[model samples]
Target: MTDATANTAPAGAGQGSLLIKDSRTAKRNGAEGRFKMYGLIAVCIGIAMLILLLTSILTSGLSAFWQTTIQIEVTLPEEKLDKSGVRDPEVMAKVTTFGYAPLLRDGLEATIAANGIETELSAKDAAELISDESVAQLRNRVLRNPDLIGQTVSVEVMASGRIDGFYKGRVTYASAERDTNISPAQLQLAEALEDKGLLNTSFNWLFLTAPDASDTRPEAAGLGVAILGSLYMMLIVLVLALPIGVAASVYLEEFAPQNRWTDLVEVNISNLAAVPSIVFGILGLAIFINFAGLPQSAPIVGGLVLTLMTLPTIIIATRAALKSVPPSIRDAALGLGASRMQSVFHHVLPLAMPGILTGTILGLAQALGETAPLLLIGMVAFVREYPEAPWEGGLFDPATALPVQVFNWTQRSDPAFVERASGAIIVLLVFLLLMNLTAIFLRRRFERRW
Candidate 1:
């Protein structure tokens, strides 16, 4: 009996076998612990990088929201603006921006004199402190209100980009000395105007409302045209891509036969999803513009291109969402004598709505930030006028997109335009974040688990 028990007993099981961990167990535990440590380090590194990116973006771009302006009272002598004294808008409009330029120069000189501020700079040099857009703006204002002729009205004119940059720390006195567009004397005069409360920095509504200015007038440049163009294209994409993509997805996922042709189509759709966005741009340029004779730089053309690019994304996501719906629900609906179509439409689709909407919005967001395709479609053109309303042929009108605007600004020689480019990035980021949040909200509000 003792020998039988000894033979049955395991070797080396007496002292440390049960209480002490084996070498293999300890090695696995050590490996797992190291993996956890590595994952933690990776997460920390990602957070630090994100903080650095946000900090840099906010610091450089926030200043673009504030504009340096010089407020001055100008006496619009009737002889200069409307010699007929008829208060005719047509007659007032006859005086071009060049004709209005002298009045602004005189206005600045008079404001200095009235403020009791003394400066050695000539009247022309002081006028140089104002933006090139000021002349055009004043002209438009006078034309809009012809009665202002022969009356003294207060006008707030934008400071030149150099003068603006000085206050925003983009330019210094030393830098102004080297800049051809500005001088140290001009900056000193700007300082005097500030001391007297004539020059000030305030929220620039124009940055949000006004159109893009020329290379010489960065302070007058705004995101208005770009914003509107993006809105119009988004509307187009949503109107077109959502229905087409979802229908195609439904037909493929629920109704199509599992045949070689369907399999080939499926593979091609996946391939299209992986295709470079610029290829779509080239396709748009060839098909929409070159062959179809559609207007170049039109939002309509851009929307079509983006729609083609976005359809694949929406289709893929919709198919995935549809597949996530449990097969049991469909089986139950069929067991109740419902048609296959009815089962999918009534039971399967409702369950998939949240993901469908999320995918559609995310696809739209991706299309919004797309630059290469838009560039190929000629959306990079400098567009000064707002597109007409949709009913008034607006979508076909020449326009610029936000990403295209950013690209345009970065190509300019002015540092102020660079700042504007950064600001545009911030705006773009906000738009993306809002879109992602909307996706989350819709997912939570409508998503159901079966």
Candidate 2:
């Protein structure tokens, strides 16, 4: 009996030894520390790449925020600004920007002489060193307020793009030989004027408030008009896309049966989300612009195109959100004699709202940065005037979006417009970042777990 008991104990110890061997084998087959470290290195590399991208954008874009300006005291003789002391609108209409050029030239000459700067530059050349927009600006103000037409007013005028670049060290005298807009003489005069405090650099509010200018008026160009156009398009997108997308998502996720037709729809939606944005632009051009006869280059058409593109993303997100709600919760609500709609609307939808909002904002950010679609829809056309009310002539009027404006500026020959393009990009990126941040905030604020 003792021998038999000893034999059973040895067998039990052998089985335990086998189990320990198997456990050791499993640990040996698991991922190694080196493999895990490789993943960590990959993540670190990705973060470094992201930092490099941000640093490049910020460095190139920071210069766009400031501009060179010249402060001039100009005596607007009543003869030029207001031909008739009676302030006749007809007389003011006849006075062109050219009429104000002489006054600016005179002011520049006075400034140069007063500063005792010895230069061979003529008054015309000195004034040309400043922006042509300044002439128009002075003329417009005098016409608007005829009371100031005869008075000597202190005005701060934007410097010419080349002059501005020169002052900022972006354009040196050596580079000016290739530039047709400015010369070394102009640069020297600008330096002399800077020394006398008549010319200086300051934060460029006009870049935010003014509109796009001609190729010759880069210093005068601003993002205000394009920003408005983008806003209008977004307004249209939000008003139309959000409700329709959410409704479709709810029906598909909560009520639609798992049929072949539903399957086809789901598959097609996923494909549409993957379609290139340029395809949507082509679709918009064919359907909205050519076939439907919607106004070309209008924000309305742009909005419609963006709405179609954004819908797939929003629907996918909303459905995912709805699916995240626990099935037990839905069953409980239904078992309490609540309708399917009631169960979804009361329990499921509230839980899904945060995800839905986050997705919508991300989609809108995508739309905001879209340039290819706008390019196809004639948003590349130059727009000089602001559109009217949304319900009025707005949908038919020519408009330029921010991205489109940036694209247009980059294509110009002027170096200053490059800076303007960079500035526009900065503005667009700010909007995109804000939208993304809002998505993050929404996710954190309303996220729930079952």
Candidate 3:
């Protein structure tokens, strides 16, 4: 029996082999480990780049949120503002911005004199410390509050762009010495006024709340109009893009026949997604503005153009999301005595809703940051006035979008617009972040495991 067992066990049965790995297997494992290390390094580099971008944006843009203001006491001589002595607003409305300019200049001079902030600047040069828009601002204030016309009112007005840049560290003393816009003595006066509690750097809520000022009044410039314009365009895009995109996606994914025509349509849709945004801009300019006669620079036109641009993206995302749903869900719904339409709508559509909404919002966010198309549609035009209420004439009113506004500001000669553009970018990023976060939340909220 022992001889039979030895023969059956075959040759070398008593010899044992070591459990060491094969050389090829070891090399493969080492290669895998190195690949993982490379991947980790790549991820770390991406994270570092993201951090650097955010840090640069925040540091450069945060200064726009704080503005240097010169607090002045203006004695509104009755002879100048309230000659009628009736304290009537209608009478005050007749006083043009020119009529109000001397008062602001006198106020700045008096403030400097009262604070003993002596400088080499003359009375005119001292007044130049304040924004040119201050005249209009003061006139509007008096028109709004006629009783203030006869009173010595203390007002905090925005400093000129150059003066504000002095406090923001953008304009150094040496730079001011060479700049034709402002003198170094003005900076000295500003410093003294700051010490006297008259000049200050405060949180500028006006950056969010006020409208854009003239090219020369960058300190008083704000994103309010641009924000509203973007909001309006988003509303229009959301309303138009979601329904149309989803409908097209649904038909193409589930209902449409598989044929050459359908294949051609699908290929076109895919190509549209990759098309340059500037091409969409040109299309919008030609089709919407020229042919359709829609008002240029209006949110309605911008929204329509964006809707066209965003449709391909939304359709692609929605179709991919629909395809992700298991065929078993549809079969089960149909087997349970449901029609094809009911099966798709009740079971498949609900499951795909999260992805649909996510994709739509992401598309909208993309549209919100678009500038080229808007520029072609004339949204790059300067817009200082706020649009009417949405239901009234807001959609048709000429407006400037946030990205276009940033572009416009960057093109200006004023250094302060640099800060404004950066600040606008921060605002745009916040919006994009919020939209992306919402997309994430929606995806997680309704995602199904089956």
Candidate 4:
């Protein structure tokens, strides 16, 4: 019986050994490993998608930053221009773009003839090599310097959009065959002109500094107005939203009593953060536009709408930042004879400030890219004229935002407009990048370890 008991005890001890792996434990470990791998794959996928998006944006938009321009020595015949012996501004203004077209065509012809660029294109088709805005551009130049109208002056004029696209690889020789806008002969002529230094590509500063152009003048299009409008809206939002958001958050988190009313307000604020941005657009349209009678397409209205959308986000972030502060901080301040208000303001608010600023800037970045709210407020209109200076009714003037401009450009039939749209996106992304960097810098600068 002792031998039999000894054998059973040895078998029981072997069965209870910790070295043996349990089936369930092995399965759980395998599952955890697979989950980690999945998370890693997700992160890699996200990074790949970001890289692809950036690559596409840069590829499609980089061409918009440079332009093809032709150098021509134009002999503005005295007979055609300033026909009235009096070099009067009003008389010059009466000479329409048509009156200037012949001089531009003649200049291009002379440049081609002198540079030995032989082409089958007639004087009419040669005129096609220049942008539709070239006449107006020349007119404006002459208007700015009236004495130069009759003088032989060297001027740089923008090449046609198709010619610009050709150099940028958007228009190929074969594609130009079917395109009525440009022919292969024209492309060859352009190449010859390039070789002789009559035509060249250079950085297009006008695109960044000038205003939007009409559909017929894509080469002259620019983002300056849109950028200015967005800047104005952001200024309005920063002025109105930051102070109001911080004050509301401070009151609710630190001072407000925990009651049903407060609870309801908190719940509503949370809900608002999740609401669709377009709903705020509708609310703005109804209240600000319809009720208050504010000007449609004004930056002020857009700012107010975005301020509402940003408020809840700011509140949520500020509260979370406040809540992250340790209770010990409050107690220590109180123990030091600080009042409740003083304790919160002097101790808690400072600690939470980094998060508040980060969140507020992030919220503003989000607002900067928003199109829906601005769309409903009539900011989608074709705004050719720039907004007046701030003192001269700029806020109330008709102006378009960057996102709305992008939307408008995409709707156009011209492929050059698409490039313009992409370029605008690059600019918008740059602004967002700067804002986010500022947030990160501020966070690190003010972050507290305790």
Would you give me the overall lDDT of model 3?
A: 0.89
> lDDT of each structure?
0.91, 0.86, 0.89, 0.89
Query: Tens-digit lDDT track for model 3 on 1-450?
Result: 333343456566423433554454467678989999999999999999999998998888999999888899998887888788898888877778888888988888888888777787888988888888777888888888877867899998988999888888899999988999988888888888889988888999999978888887898899999999999999999999999999999999989999999999999999999999999999999999999999999999999999999999999999989999999999999899999889889989999999899999999999999999899899998888899889998999988889998999999988889899999999999999999999999999998888
Displacement of residue 221 (Cα, Å) in model 4 is 1.7
Off by over 4 Å in 1: 1-18
TM-score of each: 0.95, 0.91, 0.93, 0.91
CA shift at 321, candidate 3, in angstroms? 1.4
Top model number, TM-score: 1
lDDT for 121 in candidate 2 is 80
Instruction: Estimate, for each residue in 46-126, the C-alpha lDDT of model 4 and write its tens digit.
Output: 999999999999999988999999998798876787898587878878888998898888989998898887888898888
lDDT of 2 by residue, 1-450 (tens): 323333365445335443244443445445465688899999999999999977776666667789899988888788767656789767787978777889988977776777788889878778887799998888788777888877788888889888888866789989988777788988988888888898889999888778889998888998877988898998888888899999999999989999999999999999999999999999999999999999889999999999999999999999998888889999999999999999999999999999899989988998898999999999998888888878886866788899999999999987778888888888999999989999999999999877
Write down the worst ten-residue block by lDDT for model 1. Answer: 1-10
- Weakest 10 consecutive residues, lDDT, candidate 3? 13-22
**Highest lDDT against the true fold, candidate:** 1
Scored by Cα lDDT, where does model 1 land?
Answer: 0.91
